[model samples]
Each structure stands twice: as C-alpha cells, then as structure tokens.
Target chain A: MTTHPHMALVLSRICARFADEERHDLSVLRDVTFSVRTGSFVSIIGPSGAGKSTLMRVILGMMLPTSGEVVRNFSRPAMVFQNYALFPWLSALDNVAFGLRMSSVPKQERERVAREKLKEVGLLHLENHYPAQLSGGQRQRVGLARALAIQPDFLIMDEPFSNLDTITAEELKADLLKIWRAYGITILMVNHLIPDAIELSDQIILMGAHPGHVEKVVAIDLPRPRDTRGALFFQDVDALTEEIRKIS
Target chain B: MIRSVTHPQAGPWHRIHLMRHRRALILMTIVIGIAVLFGISGYFSGVAWPTLLEAVLRTTYRLALAYGIALVLGVTIALLVGWSPFIDFFFPFFDILQNIPSFALFPLFIYFFGFTDQMIILFATSSIVWPILFAVLTAIKGAHKDLNDAATIFGATGFRRVSFYLAPLALPAVLTGSIVGIAIGWEAIIGAEIIANIAGFGAFIKNVDISGIDASAVAGALAILVIVFVINRLVWAPLLLESSRRYAE
Candidate 1:
C-alpha cells in the first residue's frame, strides 16, 4: 500500500450532550479522541448504547461536539448510514450521482462516473431501480456506491451491516475490504459484531456506556480475510466481548 | 386395472381465471354506467351549451389562479414550519385557522375587497391552503434520516438541499395535498362567484336558477364534473400512480 504523510482525520477530546426539558440529560459521548491514519481501516465496537453512532455523527459534522475539535483533511467526507438512506424517489444510479450533481459535475460525466461506480459494486444492472425495489443488501450496496463515487478521502460508516442477514453481511464485509484495498480510502466504521470488526479492521476501539467513552483500543495484527476459527481471532473477540459485558 | 389421475393445471388461462372476479367488476361497471347515464340525460335537456361552456372556461381560469397562489404560500409555510422550531410552535394557530369555514368569510371578504375578482381569489386561496401545507409538513417531518444524512455529508446545504433533496422527497405528499386543495378551491370559487355575483360559472348557475332553467345549471355542474374527471385521469391520476410505483414501499 502506498503511504501518505498526512493523517486522514483527527478527533480530539470530543464531547456530545443532548438535553430535553422533559427528561434528564443524555450525554452520549464524552472526551472521545482518536486519529485515523491515511488509508487505514478503523473499526469501533461496542454493545448497544455505547455511543458508537454518536461518535460517527460527530465525525460527519451532523452533531456538533460540546467541546474539543474534529479536524478532517478531506474537503468531502462521505458516510454510509446504518439504514442505507437511499432516496426513495431516485433510482440507484441517481442516488450514487447525487453528490456529483451537488458538486455541479457535468450531467454526462456524472452519469458516466456514477455508472462506473455502480458497476464496481456489481449494481450496474439495477441502475434504474429505485431503493424501494431493492432488497436490504442491494440497498446498502447502492449506499456504498454513492459514498464511493464521491471520491472522498474519508469514509465514515455507522453500523452499515447490522440490519442484514448474517451471510449477506459477511459477503458485504468482504466486498467492503476489497473496495477499501482497491481505492485505498480511509474508513472508520462502527460495528456491534466483534468478529466483523476483527476481520475488517486494522484497529478496534471498544466503547463503554454510562456517559459513553472509549474503554479499550486494540491493534489487530491478524491479516486480511481473518479466520474466525483461528486462536488469536477468538481470543480478541472473547476479550472484547468480556469487556463489553463488564460495561453493561 | 388402470387408474387415471388428474393434477391441477397451472397455465396462463388458469391465472386469468384466478384474476377475473365477477362481483367487483360488475359493481364498478354498474356505478360508472349510472353516472354516465345521468351525464347524458343532463346534456340533452335544454341546457344552453355555449353559455355553460364559457362559464366552465371561466371557472378553470379562476382555479388556475387560486391554485398557483396557494401552492407558493402553502409550500413556503410548510417548509418554514418543518425546519424551524419557532415556526412549529405556531402550528396550532394554523390548525385553528384551517378549521374556520372558508365560506363563512365570504361576507367579510366582499366587504373588504368590494365583490371583485380579488374576493373570489382570496376565498379560493383560504380554502386551498390548509391541506397542501399540512401535507408538506407531514412529509418533511417523516423524511428518512439516512437520506438527510447523505445530503449533509455530500455537502448539500441551504438552497441546494431544499431544492434537490427536500423537494423531491416531499413531492408525492405535496401532490396529494395539492389535489385536495384544488378540489376545495373549485368549491370555494363556485360558491364565492354565486354569493359575490362574480362573472363566473357559479354566477351563471345562479342566473339559470333565476330564469327557472334548471337543466342549464345541472349541465354547467356536469361540465365541471367532467372537466375535473378528465384532469384527474389525464394529469393527477397518472402522476400519482407513477409516484406510488416509484416511491412507495
């Protein structure tokens, strides 16, 4: 892999809080800090309500941090939402081309590039099909294509495969790794499945609830296409599972 | 002994048989046939064809005017209420206003606007606004979170996001609302013209009533019905069906 000198994104002492008059304070994130190197694939794993999604919102600038800073090197950072978020009214091709249109790319070139990106994700045949017509896996693939077509330097994905069936999720995970390797874009993904994080990521940041914070950061030395049957893989998964258990 | 066995046949004929239910089709045909019969009877009964035709045209012009104004006002208000919390707090006022019968304001409108075109337009607008505004607000509130996130992440902000993402996503709901609004506008325009003595279909219908020509008023009403039906079939129905096909889950 080619090395780049600059880091892709840096989150320093980030904090998020939600307040409602009817309820007590909801502090989803506190003092969360991390840095993703250029072209690195980082995964965040936690049980439910660990602020994994909150962290992603902060990174995407959808939720502003109450304190600290999030510095991104990229002008545009694309995100794959957990729900796939494809526009119901638009076809898969139009969904992928949305960013291109926003940037005022020429109509013909945008269509051409969007077509190429959809083809890359094995969705060229479904270009004219709207999101409502697609299966769950197909919709997520379209979402991935949309993020990819933007040619973003950083890709933030929030629980992208959690809604899929196990087999389809695995297939999509493998596809994601292949795309990540081919394009060399920086990826930061959140996952509840420990094995998924181990298989797809270079590093895993485990989060704990009760005013959510990072509890552990483990560097996975295991190679790509990681074997779940392997001893080290099971060890890491078990350890992370135990850590999550303690928090809950 | 040889035994003959029969299996259920599965073929295009069988499928057609399964799809062709008699009772529902018969019922629908009967209702439509009755309506057409009444329409034809009304057409043949000494109705002044040219006069009613002119009145129908005038009514269409008034509908166009009222609908155009309501579209702009309703959509703008809905967007404001959807996006801003401050505006949303005032939504109750809108609800109360919508409940106030638009026809009840006819006297007030005539008093202020002096029984002119302006009174008719104002009445039509008042009747049309509520449905379109509510439809748009509901749509905006119910928008999918993922699409909104995608728009933001893609740098779709301000006017661009409103035009591309919000507008297209809310289009089906807006169309549905506009249809209701147009229907209301039609009723209001006719009623206002009758009460206010405007130069339109309702005034013509009142004149026919005064002349004891019941058939002409009926014919004029029938003409309006036919025009509405054609617009629904040719314009709104096809668009709605297409949108539902493309967007409905």
Candidate 2:
C-alpha cells in the first residue's frame, strides 16, 4: 500500500456478469485489476470479446462490477464512445456544452468554454451544425470537444478513432496526444490495434478473452514525439503484437 | 490565397424553410378559397350567418378541449410507462383499450356524465390519446443506446435527462402522433355530438338532415373542411415540419 494517492483510478479484481433471457448468468469480465497513474496515458489493448468496452464502463462507474471494486479519485470523468454519441437534436456547440449545463454552470460561461474546446479540436466553425450534418471525423471531434469541455481529471476514450478513415484516425491520434500533453490529464483508452497502444500509451494493459481478464501490463519508455514508422517503434509494435496475439 | 467559396444553397434547413413558406402560401390560398365557398353556399342555402357561426364556435370548443386534454394525458402516460418491463404488460392492455371503439362506450359515458360537454370531451380524449401515446412509446423505446450512455456519463439525471435527451428524441413521434390524434378527436367528437344531439356542429348537421338538406348544410360542410384545413395549417403542419426538420430520420 502506498502512502500517497498516486492513482487517478483503481480497479481491484473487477468482475462483471449479465443474465440472458434464460436467466443464466454470463460472465463478461473476471478478476480484472489495474491502477491508472495520475497524468499518464494508458491503453487497454485486446481482440474482440476481450471485455474492453465493459472494462471502460466499469471504470467510468456507469456499470457496477459484480465482485470487485472501482475507486475513482477524481470526479467528473468524461467519456468519448466508439460511436461518438453526439446528440442529433443538438448543435455541436450545445452538445459540447452539455456537461457544463449538467453541472449547472452559468450559460455564458458554458458557451465560452464549449467554444474554446471546439476551437481546440478545430471544430469552431461547425458550432451551429448538428451531428447529422457532420462527417464521422467531425463527429468524433465534437465528442472530444464535449468530453474535454467538462475539464475532467480523467478522460476515458473507447476506441475513439475506430469509426474514422485511416487518415482521419492518424490525424486524430496525433491531435489526441497533443491534447494529452497540453492538458496533462489522465487518459485511459481502449483500442484494438496493438501498434496504436504501443505508439500512444505510456503503459499498455493487455487483456485476454475467455471471460476477459488482464493478461499483462507493458511499459513504453520511448520518448515523446516518437515516430510511428521508425525502427524502435516497429520493434516495440512487433513485440507487443506477438504478445497480444499469444494472450488473446 | 484566393479560393472559391461555395456555400450549398440546398441544405436540409434551406429546403425545409422553402417548403414551409410554400406550404403556408398554399394553406392561405386554401383558407381564402374555403371562405369564398362558404359565402356562396350560405347565400344559396338560406342558412343564417349567426346560427352557422354559433355552431362552428361550439364544435371548435369541443375539439380544442378534447385535443388539449389528449395532448397532455397522452404524453404524461407515455412518460409514465416509458421503456421497461412494464411496457410488456402495460402496452397490450393499452392496445385493447384503444380498440374498444369509442362509440361502444358512448352510452356508459352518457350515463355517468349525463350527456354534458364533459361526457363528450372525455369520450373524444379516449379516442385521441392512443396514437400519441404509442408514437412516443415507440420513440422512447427505440432511442439509441449510445445516446443514453452519453447522457448518463454527462450526469444527466431525472428531469434533466428527460428534458435534454428523451424529449428531443421523441419530438418527431409526438408531432406525428398529435396529428393522428387530432384527426381521430374530430371524428369521435362529431360522432358523439350526433348520437347525443348535443348543441354543436354535429347537432346542426343532424337537424339540417331532418329538416331537409339545403345550401346551409352545404355551407356547414364547407365550414368543417375549413376548420380541418386551418388547424392543420396553423398548428399540426408547422409542428410536423419543425419536428421533421430537427429530429426526422
């Protein structure tokens, strides 16, 4: 046990279960334990059915684990879902300002902060547009803007770039790192690509299927602004890929 | 660097705006045409203008009261019976209740309410509420799960959740249902009046039929058509357009 409160969030042997139509209990996650260090980028990497999304929900406190505990040291944790989840009825500005309104922030301040966040994500011009009017990339940016506008101590992203094209995803990944470094906020991202986890995270939590559990946690000691196409990056990517393949 | 600025003139909003203006113009023309027709029919049918006006006002009152009550109760019931296992049990009962023809229960209402306006209003409300309730129910049930998750994550709870998320999601459904409800309300109220011989448009039409069809009856028919057109144009049409513009699939 550490004396300092260094972890932003902690999951102690979390397990989630669901009952089917037949009332038979099905395990979705099992004995998943992890600690997210404050102000660091961590990625949860695994294949399909690895309970990655379920893990995110548990950490976000949206869903309760069956047998384990989740401790969030910070309040106001925000999430960007794989589908972006922008409200179709709301304008981009309104969507971004939603969390502030929920917090009962003054309207003017909410608009100002929402606009700033949108500008940060380079979506300032689309403030009046609805999600239906936006491209997939633009929609994800709006989701990012919305999450960031809350000024949360913790930001959880569930496959944020999964719906975008390759170029948009690459650009988004770069923008995300830039924001992470600029804000110095703790981020826990769930991603399917092992190379992406190695590229963006300070630590990668590899998860395995069969009632999904944490398999391994690998640290990336690479320097900031690391080149994705560089030799060191490739080696780390290859090693992590092989390890993930073995476990998953 | 100079660039060609091409702002598309055919965006959804633009198209809706144009459509609304055109619809309004057409509605106004129809209203004017109906007024002209009413005048012609009144002159030839020998129906006094004052009597016709009284009949119109009375029917309008009943329709407004019934439709208003249905609007409030339908949405209220829908919100109360929102997506849950309750729907599985509650909806089937609601379906059966709606199918038990309004006319079939007219005698029961007349016995209890004594052929008063209250009886007519209640009967009309029963007929009007089902469409709105079911439409809202379907919308609520079919709302995207991702949107629900996002709302929860953002700390939207209780009233705020309903206002911010559920209401807007269900708006199109509400408008569509309201249109159908109004139409059914018109039918039910008119039928109730004819059966009960209440002092309204239906009674006037029944009295005209007994006395013999004249130009006055034709004028009254024209007046009914005008009322339907005006309500659609002034109320339901705009609401439908607005809802579709914002929330349609």
Model 1: runs farther than 4 Å from truth?
A1-6, A21-23, B1-46, B76-90, B204-218
Q: Report interface Cα RMSD per prediction.
A: 1.3, 1.8
For model 2, the stretches where C-alpha displacement exceeds 4 angstroms are A1-4, B1-9, B12-50, B80-93, B212-218
Give per-model TM-scores: 0.87, 0.88
Q: Compared to the true structure, candidate 2 yields what TM-score?
A: 0.88
Which 10 successive residues of model 1 chain B have the least lDDT summed?
B6-15
Task: For candidate 1, list the clashing residue pairs, or say none.
Answer: none
Q: How far is A63's C-alpha from truth in model 1 (Å)?
A: 2.2
Q: Chain A TM-scores, one per candidate?
A: 0.93, 0.96
lDDT per residue for candidate 2 within B133-157, as digits (tens), equals 9999888887777788899899787
Candidate 2 lDDT, A82-182, residue by residue in tens: 98888888899999999999989999999999999999999999999888778899999999999999998899999988889999999899999999999
Candidate 2: lDDT of B145? Answer: 76
The residue-level lDDT of candidate 2 at B243 comes to 63
lDDT of 1 by residue, B7-37 (tens): 3234354455445434435654675676578
What's each prediction's clash count?
Answer: 0, 1
